[model samples]
Target: MSYELKSAGALSGGTCCYAGSRLPVRGPKRDLDSPYIAFLGGTEVFGRFVKTPLSDVSESLLKMPCVNFAGVNAGLDTFASDQALQSVARSSEISVLQLLGAQNISNRYYRVHPRRNDRFLQAQPPLKELFPEVDYTEFHFNKHLLSSLQARSEERFAEVRRHLQEVWITRMQEVITTLEGRVLMLWVRYDLKGSAAFNHEPVLVDRSMVSALLGSTMGLVEVDVATAGIEGDFDGMIMGELDFPAAQHMLGPKEHARIGCALAEKLQGLI
Candidate 1:
């Protein structure tokens, strides 16, 4: 389970574009003037640790230029605020947007950093009033703050969950509407898991929730790669000695290839 440690610099080959983006994106820099496919999502879409991500593999399979606009720990708010990234997505013939965890987004109760959606910026009055004794300022990330809140009182945390889901749907709708081309919703999950519980990421949102959020014109592509075949194969896929603990859970090269093929097949039908 050892991978050739390739830093972001090495994989990107010292060529990254930041023209309309807050962060540097993976690139040889494809021409935006011509036809291309845009891939938008969180860390998985960015293909952290893995040498080849879905965008690169899909580009080879479909014979089209693919732009990777995904940001690590990105949420709907990240896309909603970035006009430059939005323009790139609008210009593409088709855009594949990964279904990121709803928890990373901001809601009426709290706010997240615009660029790094996972970082907890501040708590709104409602959240403060709910847990007046808890010092929210001590927290740095959304997951940690929410986990602590839930531990204090499940009833109060229920309200937080409700607000997050509502905001997630609203922000997602707003983001999807701005895209000009055919947008395909790509749901790439480890597996179909349990209900949304406290102390865990909001990785699984209800299908009905997603269906209601997206417009009728959009397409849905669900890829669950938690099968026995690929579940234990992470040898060369994950980058070793990473600071982030979450990098260990990322999908390997085999899963990325599978997802790429599935995306290619789905795109063929749409195009």
Candidate 2:
């Protein structure tokens, strides 16, 4: 179970851009001439410091090509806004959509970069009006903006959270509809806060919100990374000094394996 950790920069697959897609995705890009399954989402789907992602693991078990279209720090909006990437994913046999956090996407209060959903574009009038006393220029990331807003006032932060949750549901549905095929939903989290909890991964998304979107998906594969006991387990991951902080928060090989197996099980008869 003990594997040597290497530098994150040493990973083999570099990102590549498809002809029509605007965003660069994790590479070892597949030839689209043949049928293949597409796995879509953010950092976890991209596998970060982990060598083999769930997409690769599932490919080995299913005996088919699984194209990983995820990017580091990517989120739902990254795909939701990309018509080209959506076209590429729509053509796949099925697309595995990772249920990333709600805060990364654009809402009434703020805007995120279309390609990199984690990047905060600019706060809208609503946000400026809500947090009139706070200087918006200081925020360059969605999490930073959200955290600052929360720190300002919990009562006001609830309003922002509610707006994000609503927008997330609508945006997810649009993405699912845009994909227009067997779209499997994957939920990998370190906690089950019962309600929309910010401290948990898939930040600000709760069971009820997922339930609202469930009918649109092929099915849902929910994994509690902590319950599976992979929260603090960082063995098998390769990272350098800069990669350490993020790597620590990311799920490792064992966790990805468990997720891959669960996803493959849900994917059994579909593909």
Candidate 3:
């Protein structure tokens, strides 16, 4: 069986203000004064097309509120730079941080737009030197630029990959340190076939990277949902034509439910 598709108009819920942060947060607004869990990450955490994200479903199962602080293409830098969002996350009883791709975050090689982490801003000195032949201005997104760079020369692109991994680790550590209370790092992927190939954009940070970055935290829960299962389980659940092409890759209701169940089980002792 598959989920019935709901029109975009039907899923429209008014936005909520998180501590005066100008960025509009998706909501069926929950009370912030009460004890709650904070969910942070990129598109999947934001639940782009699905009516109920993992955070909401997890909240229902736990009989507690979960505040979704995710944004489209959100990187570690996006959350780290937002003081207000950090304040809200610190106040939460616990946090669930989704492991996003490393490419979106800014590093020594390149910079991404602050709000729209996917948008490529400018190539720094190192990146420019690496790809002097190519015009950086021609690129719009980090993934596209990286793909082009990789296609040009895999050996040189390895250096770019290394920088991103380092930056991702450092930023993740910084975010975790800034947040108060217990923090659980969650990794959700398309399939159980392990990480995606280097040529692919998604799953930039694989299982080994996750283990290395979050050593002894004992708070990481990796969820690898089967792609075929998601497609079979949820019919017409993806976003409409107006939505970005990437939206089609996001998790559906059944996948969210699976994630929620895992979270609820994991948080049994913590909260």
| Highest-scoring model, TM-score | 2
- The residue pairs that clash in candidate 3, if any, are 3-235
Highest lDDT scorer: 2
Query: What is candidate 2's TM-score against the reference?
Result: 0.91
lDDT of each: 0.74, 0.82, 0.76
Tens digit of lDDT per residue, candidate 1, span 56-122?
8898998988788887777778888888888888888888988777777877788899978889999
As for lDDT, the candidate ahead, 2 or 3, is 2
Lowest lDDT 10-mer window, candidate 2?
190-199
RMSD of 2: 3.0
Candidate 3: C-alpha lDDT: 0.76
**lDDT ranking, best first:** 2, 3, 1
TM-score of each: 0.88, 0.91, 0.88
